[model samples]
Target chain A: MSEPDGGTVGKAMTVLDQVANFGRPVRFSELLKDSDFPKATLFRLVQTLTQQRLLTYDNQAQTYLPGLRLVQLAHAAWAQSSLATVAAPYLDELAHKFGEAVHLAQLENGQVLFIDKRQSVYRFDTLAQTGQVAPAYCTGVGKAILAFMAPMERDHALRQQAFVGYTPTTHGAPDSLLQELDAIRASGVAYDREEHERGIISIAAPIMSDDTNVLGAVSIATSTSRHTIESLDRFEAVLRSTAAQIGSAARVWRAPMPANPSYGNSGGENS
Target chain B: MSEPDGGTVGKAMTVLDQVANFGRPVRFSELLKDSDFPKATLFRLVQTLTQQRLLTYDNQAQTYLPGLRLVQLAHAAWAQSSLATVAAPYLDELAHKFGEAVHLAQLENGQVLFIDKRQSVYRFDTLAQTGQVAPAYCTGVGKAILAFMAPMERDHALRQQAFVGYTPTTHGAPDSLLQELDAIRASGVAYDREEHERGIISIAAPIMSDDTNVLGAVSIATSTSRHTIESLDRFEAVLRSTAAQIGSAARVWRAPMPANPSYGNSGGENS
Candidate 1:
């Protein structure tokens, strides 16, 4: 809550984030305890957000939760800005063909933000829900996207990584992770190897535009109980093809825009 | 373009809404054309929003679209505040059982806001996407929720209705809709009868808590080519039971809150 630099808008967004982070309908007092804003400022910010329908105040519960207006705005974001909508049919095809969960993700704020997922009907619980975030260093989709980024952009993103090891196989340092990225760049695929979670592993490929710009990544994820690391390699060819198809489709959809040298290829900055 | 009531936060939100309404990545010039703010004011606001990641500036396109942060916040809102997550399993069941699309919606600002939808594998094109808003006076889910609302609350919602006929079967006045609501109340369900969209009809039931609080509504929608108004009645019993099951499950999930008399039954105010 160090005052974000965008003035009143930033403060208001910070307040919105505070409420969302509570992850439940929360009391004003609870928000106050955690907020960096003064009591009066916090109150005014909350009131403004509620009035604008950015946060909904639950009367009976005497609590506030993220509002429906966010969902409305987010729908536009997902449909317009994200590759999720463009990749949906491909994800569905891959998921159905393999009968495993598939994830579509983009680098956001130097992290892996899962924008969409297709869970098979035979759903085994996997932690990757749409909109969930994970460390870029340890996840398959994240590494795949990172591996394909321009060197400068990749370096910037790597600088932001904490590289906390979540499992024995997790990357413990930027150097170690960079080595794997070099391999992924050569092979055109990345693997999770139960790095982010104990049992879950995935095979992932970076989706690249026809011009070789990194768009995002898609992954086919499963449990160690279901498949060994060697067995996961069986999906490599189909996964890469699906990624290519989505990338081609997305490029067509985005063809109207003039290309700027500064965007898309920069791993997560301004994403 | 009128300045909204909540000051800077309001103005900022208005800008955000403007971006979302564009429904595509749009240039600053395009946004300026539609904006009411002075050029300097608009520039500052846009810059602020972009910095906060409430809107993402597409450098390559030189345009802006709603941002990934909104998607993350929206995911929490959908999971925590919306009935979508609660009704998901039931929506899946109903959609599979009938091989028709099932919609979950809540009234927001006197309009029907679809929070979730389950489309059958045999997907026929329908206008109802998640986060899509429709008139409350005519749609099945809208009418069903209105039928169960407390009288004063229902009246408040009715006054907000424009009552423009979308089809020949659409309700044209409060009196006509009130008459239908009475029947729906008596019958414990509502039918669309191609009122909102020709050839598309639905059977809907209000999801109520054990205390009879209207949580929201669920509708199973289909085309006239698939089902007649009388034939739609075949789903009435199962639809009502599904709504009841969802209501029970949601109530349990929400049981931590103290009962407030003024909320949940108010149709759309503060929703």
Candidate 2:
């Protein structure tokens, strides 16, 4: 995940991410073992990052985790990002109405990053945790976003997918996934029928700006024991509407766009 | 706010923060006006930051904002910080029971940075937004944490306060605030009597680990129109218990230790 860009700043960030990727606080030696950077460089980077309060070091455990500074910055990011703050009330309403788990996800680094989640009142352990990442080839939210992308961007995003089969229903090749994407474009919906996980299923729709920009995706998830895939069909209209609401809201509430529009842009470039 | 430490890395972060402080997408010229760095230096910093994904540039608006990477890092921080994740269930219960806004906060750079918030069903525009920063001398969560800190640490923290009164009841000096802190330590809670905002009042309690370490604070905030200061007292027992539960949970699920403990150590150093 560490791409050597932006010189010293890039290196420092790589070290910072390594620690964060662990989720649990990590010791220096543990980081050293996993990092591609040399020991001296890694140590210096860690030291500087700690001094900057970008990485907090715990004395007792002798490990490092993300610092409070990151948390503070993230607050700003959430406000700017369309998926979390902009869609908060809508997600709340969706969860309240359906009485099932609801999730909002955005494409980050060509992978499906679950930005926010609302746990169902009747909880069963579902693998989709907030900030958890998954393959774009199998999951409902992932397919929803992939379906609406411009062909070139869609192909680029598709190439990045691992295409690992998680279950019998999972897409294992690019051609099969492309076929599904074509179908999703026509239907304006994507479904996961035990594709990502056994007994878990969800119906998803892509959130798009008025100009057809792929903002993100929203999904209503439940276990098969509680609800079948057909039962999830009842939520299609609601999911699409919720996604549209978020997309329009995102259009009004714009965030800073990237300098390189070819990679990730607000508007659908190919369209 | 920029101390100019860590050379290039520090300057880069300072530039990043100035953009974030705007709380909206900001142009390069606008950033230049507020930044301590020279124009060329500032430009370079922004470019490097954008490349690193620490800051995002909007090609359409030609502005900058916090990037998705920060959001990614923040997800890790939220889980690791313990205040938010460890206290999630408690916060949900508190908000559900009182049907009032619940805030969880931690001290950062002498300011109170809200880590998480549970909005009551009834929505009203109270000043506190999640991940928002507020003056430590005036807010309930701020004072609650301050009151429990060691005397020496308290004085250091107090020195950092601007003490600019936002309302008539806001603490104007260290002596008066110290008196309130003493009262809080004795009563096991702190109150904001429309101190930070004209109509906002909250009852808060410090979350502590063992006998001394002040982890953070939790508050039940409501508009004065909803309830009087005396009426807020009814929440004292519940707030204290909630704070205790979070503190205990935090102790069990600790994050990593710092390399240098003196600056921001875990222990209540004075004790």
Candidate 3:
């Protein structure tokens, strides 16, 4: 992973990441063991973060966890910037219509970041949750967005892909993934075919602002026990419609803002 | 709100809060107009935040929104640290049982910060969403937790409250709220009675560790059209039971960790 180079703020954020990645109340010692910074510097950073309410210090546990402030800020992030808020009603509609899980995602730093999800009431265990991230080359949503991205942007995204074979059907190289992208462009949809995880399959469609600018992707995911890859084709029409609706809603939402010359018209990449 | 006081990290976080509070794609000029920091300092902070991916710069719109990294970190925060994850299944059960919206929240910096929510299929317009914050003096979950808090902590929390009359039922002073807290302590439940919102009412129970340390609060909320304040009594039994179960689950989840002297045994207030 590339380390942030924004000085003190960056260092503090990295420390925050270390605590969060542990996914449990982590000790300063445990963080120090894995961190690049020296003990004193790390200690001060953690202290500062705790003071800022970005890292909560568990008194009884003597460990650190990501703070409640993140939850507050994240709420704002989801409501304000994410396609999740715009896509919510549509996701609910799609999920209720099909009785299948629906996921809405956008590319963040060349990976697919799930911004929202609606689990089928029938299915209790869902692979994706809001805020989960997955490889851009393997997942249906990832591939759908990739297929719709501009060539220069697509190549940049592809270069970042590790191409790890997560399953037998997973793409193993850029060439293989690129081939699938071509097929997706033709079909206007992408299929996971259990590429990212065993028994999980999804049909995904890109949510685009126009012909070239990809906003995000939406997918209806299910287990192999429920549907075969060919059988998943039944959801194509509704899924595409939902994607288009979200895309249009998103476009209208952004239409009020004037375009900036510094960054082109495409919403291809955001930093 | 008190600004963070941890130097550069604090400044960056303040800038982040400014961006997030806008709840839209905000321009630097708009941020500068409302900011306490001078233009150069604010500009540097925003640039640093964008680089660190704590803030995303929209290329086309030439605006900033809280970054996707926050969503990722907040996911980890929610799963690992927030009571929301532990309380999710119980919230689901409560929501399903009553066919009403259930909210899980914790006290953060003297405010009620909703960490998770389960919206009833029967009710779509929920008053609280995960990550939303409200005054601890007015809301059901807020009052429930505050009633069970230690005097010192409760006083501190009370001081932070503005006592704004969101509705006529909202407590106008600490003395009035304290009297109600006493009643809540005796009843082992708190009722909103449309205090925070005119048409909405809720029954709440505090999730406590032992008899002293309050973990958080859970509430089942609905419109007054559906149930009167007296009618909400039917949900009290289940609500209390759910709170107990969550408290137990939370205790078990924290049992293995040793206490630190820097803070104390209580999980009452966290940074």
CA lDDT scores, all candidates in order: 0.87, 0.84, 0.88
Error of 3 at B64 (Å): 1.4
For model 1, which pairs clash? none
Give one digit per residue, the lDDT tens place, for model 3 in B176-199. 889999999999999998888888
Over 4 Å off in model 2, which ranges? A1-3, A254-271, B255-271
Top DockQ prediction, candidate number: 3
Which ten residues in a row are the worst by lDDT in model 3 chain A? Answer: A261-270
Estimate, for each residue in A9-89, the C-alpha lDDT of model 3 and write its tens digit: 888888898888887789999999999899999999998988888988876667898998998998888888648878888
Total backbone clashes of candidate 2, pairs 3 or more residues apart or in separate chains: 9
How far does residue A154 in candidate 2 sit from its true spot (Å)?
1.9
What is candidate 1's lDDT per residue for A174-244, written digit by digit as tens?
88888999999999999999999999999999999855579799999999988998999999999999999
Local lDDT at B52 for model 2: 79
Q: Which candidate is the best by TM-score?
A: 3
DockQ sort, best first: 3, 1, 2
How many pairs of residues collide in each model?
Answer: 0, 9, 0
lDDT of 3: 0.88
True contacts kept of 1: 0.79
Question: What digit string (tens of lDDT, one per residue) describes model 2 on residues B180-237?
Answer: 8889889998999999889889999999987878989999999988999899998999
Screening candidate 3 with a backbone cut-off below 3 angstroms (N, C-alpha, C), the clashing residue pairs are none
